[model samples]
Target: MTVKPDWLRVKAPQLERIGNVKEILRDLALNTVCEEASCPNIGECFNAGTATFLIMGPACTRACPYCDIDFEKKPKPLDPTEPTRLAEAVHRLNLNHVVITSVNRDDLLDGGASQFMACIDAVNSVSPNTTIEVLIPDLCGNWNALELILQAAPEVLNHNTETVPRLYRRVRPQGNYDRTLELLQRTRQLSPSTYTKSGIMVGLGETDAEIRQVMQDLRTVDCDILTIGQYLQPSQKHLQVNEFVNPEQFADWKAFGEEIGFLQVVSSPLTRSSYHAETSQGINETLSTLKS
Candidate 1:
């Protein structure tokens, strides 16, 4: 019998401005992770005056079982002007911290790394003061592709592990757990100064010990930040939630992460990868803010 975890209440201030943000995005013909990935914290993130920009294209090459992004056999060619358009969108939104991500485009030789760089550059050029974060794919464990993105110099580099290794076959059949770790390790090696972040979703049949191990593994890769949250099934067609983790459990994980040497950890039932990112000024800044 499946048990519903107690619904942790959230007061999302961002919901109020969601419609206006949607209208602006529609006007610009842009896509956001908020709409594409079915992120639970979309209402909160948008209401907080922030949105994660989805670049490259809406269609993905790989179909991760847990994700709801549409998979196309042959995605459309890269949009040459998408970077500038994304920059314009960021400028218009008046975002202080822009979070950019993309669909997995394994069809391209560079694994869409060039396009990722272009978007970062464009955003930086237009909004110099605004800190930028890129939540990237593993690029099939390509070192060169990793270098291209690091060269662009985003404030934070994030790549989600999504779930524990044991659940990889069921939750993320197309993705590699080892490859994701390698990618994170490479990012830190390539640019030690860049803040490296990763996330995992609980309630996927993973044990508490397994979750703790995952956090330890992230620390092994020199990850600077971590976000852990409950996994909610996006649709009937998607993978069913194995369990619902309570708010107390999330708190325990957060404390564990800090003990394991993670500089920052955001663990809550309602948390998503990019949730409350706009408020995380930087590792030191966030720590100071939290303390004061």
Candidate 2:
């Protein structure tokens, strides 16, 4: 494994106002992927008063070795109040755009899609003007669960194809590459008006050809947006960095995505699914107008 490059370093999020955002989470008892996933941009995002709300619990059902979230085969019961609390946080923050994601709940009958719907409903009730984007799991190939979540009609539906196909078994042992693509494809089939987006991380020993092929596959599914970023190893116990892709490469991918018909492309080392996610508002509007 290669040593982590200097470009991957980020300034600590030390802005005094960061505490103000943290207070909302503390008061409402909400969890965010920024903290649970050990995302490198936590300080910057929180300091800016924006975060990806991680619904359900921080524990995941599958033990994807590259992931940072805790794993448990049998996680706790879903909190009925979690939706209300999450909605309260959005209301208190006065946010116009919110990102909601959750742990893999294969243990649940609907794979946690109902909880996603509840959270979306609660947020919509209080913050009706707020546009929502959900980063969802494969639901263990439960297409019905996918339709249930899509029925809520989030502004954007996102599912990350975290790594390339070859790396699935080793990096994301439980994830299926084709299943994820099918989910994105079905999102378009079910909710054509809803903008479909998917992201993949580089530096996981994936080649440039494989990355482009993944992008092509996304376009085949009629995906509207793409986000590509560097994969940062969360801990010493996790997989080591295969290579640190540079800024220029990310820029190239961004241009390539747009050239191939993606409405927008956000590519960079710091670009996570929800990184600068507010920009999604514009993409949604454009897609809406085109459909109308």
Candidate 3:
């Protein structure tokens, strides 16, 4: 394993606050992408009293090599009580913004879109003031299922184009680059008011130019927000780190993304799809200004 660079080191968060958040999740029997994916921002996000809920599973149907979430276990049926419990946790934590993501449940007919809708409705019922963001899977090109999720009217519709097209076969075997772009394109067309967001991870052997091209492709689809981060190997069995991109390079990428007209760009070693996600609220005001 390659040694992590100094810039990638994360500070420990206040455990008391993290513990409190964990207690709420455990009590509700909810799963979080933070814990399941081994996100580096877990302690920080949890300490700040927020989490990206992983509904429908801790196990995913597709075994992406870069992800840490388990793929060996079979996906189970959606729990009817899950949305309510997630809502309760949000209400208890008094979150102003919540990100709901899921492992790919390809086994389901709607690809778990209904479960996402149920979660959104449940959250809205208990915490009407809280804005919702869902980091969703590709739904296997099921546009009908995508429409179902859009009809639910989440504040932000996020689908990760996790890697560049060139590495799609190796890095994200089951993922299609064009399909990822189409999903974002469809989101913008279906709900012009809803913010469209995507994320990519660096250091898996992609060139700087390839990264920029991906950013441009995202802008072409009118993606409103972008997150670029460094990829860390979760275990020796997972994909090895190809390179450790420096912080300055990440800043350059942010600048390039903004130059290309992304409404918001978050680029850094630790930036995740949902990390500091609440900050995108500024985009609402920006878009409103543009329209006026």
Candidate 4:
């Protein structure tokens, strides 16, 4: 028998300006993870007045079994005007905090880092008060590419570890676990003031011990923020959910993560990598004040 956890209950509220928001994005010819990735919290996020911007292109080079992103052999060229367009979208939406992510562009010599920086610059130009968060790819573990993004100086630099190292072969076949760790560590080394964040999806057959170890690995790399969420299958072709973790388990993990020295931890059924990004700034600010 399946049990629906209390935390999984989604309440749909009417978003007054959500249609205008959608029309603006449509007019700009931009795509969003909110639509592409089929995020379960879309309704809530939209109602709460926030959305994650998908930059670069819709085509990704890696074929992670758990992700539903299209694995395109050759994607279109980077749009030079995408920065301005995305900035306009943020302004139109009146976003206080914006989360920007992109498809992995291994085809580019710079691994799309320049494009990421451009988006950050564009957003900053228009929304000077808005906090910028970037969910970046590994750039194939190249520090030079990472440096370009660091120079832009987003408020948060997030690179998801995705899963435990043992599952990398099967789950993220083309992704290197060590490379991800190095990327997160290097981001901190490059900009210690920038809050470094990463996330993982549970219900992928990882044990409690393994999950704890993943937290330790993140801590060792000095990742300040962490998000743990349930792994819901996006499609039949994607990896199946091994188990739907209970809310109590998620609560226990959240407490464990805080005890492990993570400055902030978001672990819940509907939590995503970019969920509650606006509130996150306050959490990071609080932690920064404490550190000082």
- Give per-candidate clash totals: 2, 0, 0, 0
How many collisions between residues are there in candidate 2?
0
Tens digit of lDDT per residue, candidate 2, span 1-292?
5676788888977767679988889888888998899998888888777889998878889998888998954688999999999999998888768999999888999999999999999998998888888999999999999999989888889999988899999998999999999999999999988888888988889998999999999999999888999988888899988888999999999889889999889999988989988754347566344424
Which 10 consecutive positions of candidate 2 have the poorest summed lDDT? 283-292
For model 1, residues 1-118, the per-residue Cα lDDT tens digits are 4555458555655545998788878888889988898887777777766799888769999988788888855688999889988898899889877889999998899899999999
Compose the digit string of candidate 3's lDDT tens values, residues 1-292: 8898898889989999999999999999999999999999999899889999999999899999999999999888889999999999999999878899999999999999999999999998998877889999999999999999989889889999998899999999999999999999999999898899999999999999999999999999999999999999999899999999999999999889889898789999999999988655557554334333
Q: Which stretches of candidate 3 lie over 4 Å from their true place?
A: 284-292
Each candidate: RMSD to true structure?
3.2, 2.1, 2.2, 2.6
Angstrom error of the Cα, residue 214, model 2: value is: 0.4
Structure candidate 1, residue pairs in collision: 14-47, 14-48
Give the TM-score comparing model 3 with the true structure, all chains together.
0.97
Q: lDDT: which is higher, 1 or 2?
A: 2
Off by over 4 Å in 2: 1-3, 72-74, 280-292
**Candidate 4 per-residue lDDT over residues 30-136, each given as its tens digit:** 88888878888888777776789888878787788887778855688999999999999899888877899998888889889999999999998898877788999
Question: What value does the lDDT take at residue 173 in candidate 4?
Answer: 85
**Where is model 1 more than 4 Å wrong at Cα?**
1-16, 281-292
In terms of TM-score, which candidate is strongest?
A: 3
Error of 1 at 53 (Å): 0.8
TM-score of candidate 4 versus the correct structure, residues matched by position = 0.93
